[model samples]
Target: MQGPAVSGEEEPRPLLRTMLGDVLRRNRREQRRTLEDVARAAKVSMPYLSEVERGRKEASSEVLAAVCDALRVELSDVLAEVGRDLAADRVRRERVIRLDVALGRRTARPARRSGDTYCLAA
Candidate 1:
């Protein structure tokens, strides 16, 4: 059987943040590195790294890059994950736009009809 349908909504920012935090925490633990060690390597304060891992703070891209480097992981890896999340968010936005057009709440040009086929106006 098919799974339940998805709905269009703004992406869950907190959830994404939590996912990032979890990844960082798991990787650090796997490497058996103390928070202080990571902080030293990342050139950040231990308290700040702790906050980031707890999802209590939104890290700047520079800080994230440092942390990724300290973790011996590519910065692009984290960015790719963020990109996927943003793409999902974009898809949700597009779905909302389509729904609005269908409900007539937003104006849209009529689609073209040719030989029993209907195509949106370009």
Candidate 2:
């Protein structure tokens, strides 16, 4: 049996995940709290919290908000960071889409057909 083939392209780094993990670790350290302690306070399992802290898992917004509340931090702070990350991701995606359109790898649909013009089905 053949193993999975490696692509020459580098694996994309999860910047948002890394940022969340770093923020959680930094806040916990500043508060002198252990992972177990934070887990208990956040009502999350120790292992799950550990995974979150290590950026091995992507937490839902609700879970993240719960964790932030347990850490005595405002949800807005975390959400703001999340928003910024999402915006950046959206921009990157748009850029890729534009490039694809330019290269004809992707085609745009016409909004309306002129008198004699017809839109081709994509």
Candidate 3:
């Protein structure tokens, strides 16, 4: 689950799943292919492909390879695109964090109840 956004703060970095889905959907659209077309070619259920495109499901490596093959694209190419997307997102987040710090804003987690100890270590 995502944490609540702080007032006047930029939104958090998007999930990788979300970005991956966006790339897939964009590629499909650019190729003028429908979900059913790709799903059939990939030997995957149409609904499952749809869920993956919507970022509602995390697809396995095998499935991703199949989907890329169906789309006539390379898995490495798709991954590279995702990498670029993540890099851009990181730059944006860093900019926001720097701005917040410059303005003396508290950029940590949102305020919690007194005596509540939160461990953010992963």
Candidate 4:
């Protein structure tokens, strides 16, 4: 059986549902819509929609498409925005990597936490 991959993954992990929810919530708010409004239009419950918007729930693709339809946004547009955010973060990381290299650091991973504080192995 194949094992989990530990290396060869270049991109940072992307939280799909959270990013989708953020995009949906922003669009809904921009249109002056409420949970009650969008939820009703999407044919979902208020509490469930709220949870989805807060990223506490992992919604199915069907549900997401319905929500986007309710918000009058194309699903591709939401994905595009998420892609843009990820790209911006990559740029920031690359800058940090350059600075770390100039400062003589081999790698710039965040310090691992050890109980009450982070361990500075370097």
TM values, all candidates: 0.54, 0.54, 0.70, 0.65
- Candidate 1 lDDT over residue span 1-122, tens digit each: 22223463343444556657767887889899999999999999999999888878888889988999999988677667656766666554442234445455756656767766534321
Instruction: Candidate 2: list runs displaced more than 4 Å.
Output: 1-14, 79-122
**Root-mean-square deviation (CA) per prediction:** 9.8, 12.9, 10.2, 9.1
Give Cα distance to truth, residue 57, candidate 2, Å: 0.2
Best of the two (3, 4) by lDDT: 3
Q: For candidate 4, write residues 1-122 as lDDT tens digits.
A: 22223353455656777776777888999999989999999999999999998878999999989999999889899889978877766654442123454466687567767765532222
lDDT of 3 at 109: 59
The model with the greater TM-score, 2 or 3, is 3
Number of the top lDDT candidate: 3
Q: How many backbone clashes does candidate 1 have?
A: 0
Query: Alpha carbon lDDT of residue 111, candidate 2?
Result: 75
| Model 2 lDDT tens row, 1-122 | 22222343434545677668767877888899999998999999999988888888998888888789889998787667656766675544332223344455756664765676633222
Provide the overall lDDT of each model, using Cα atoms, as 2-decimal numbers: 0.73, 0.72, 0.83, 0.77
User: Candidate 2: deviation at residue 70, Å?
Assistant: 0.7
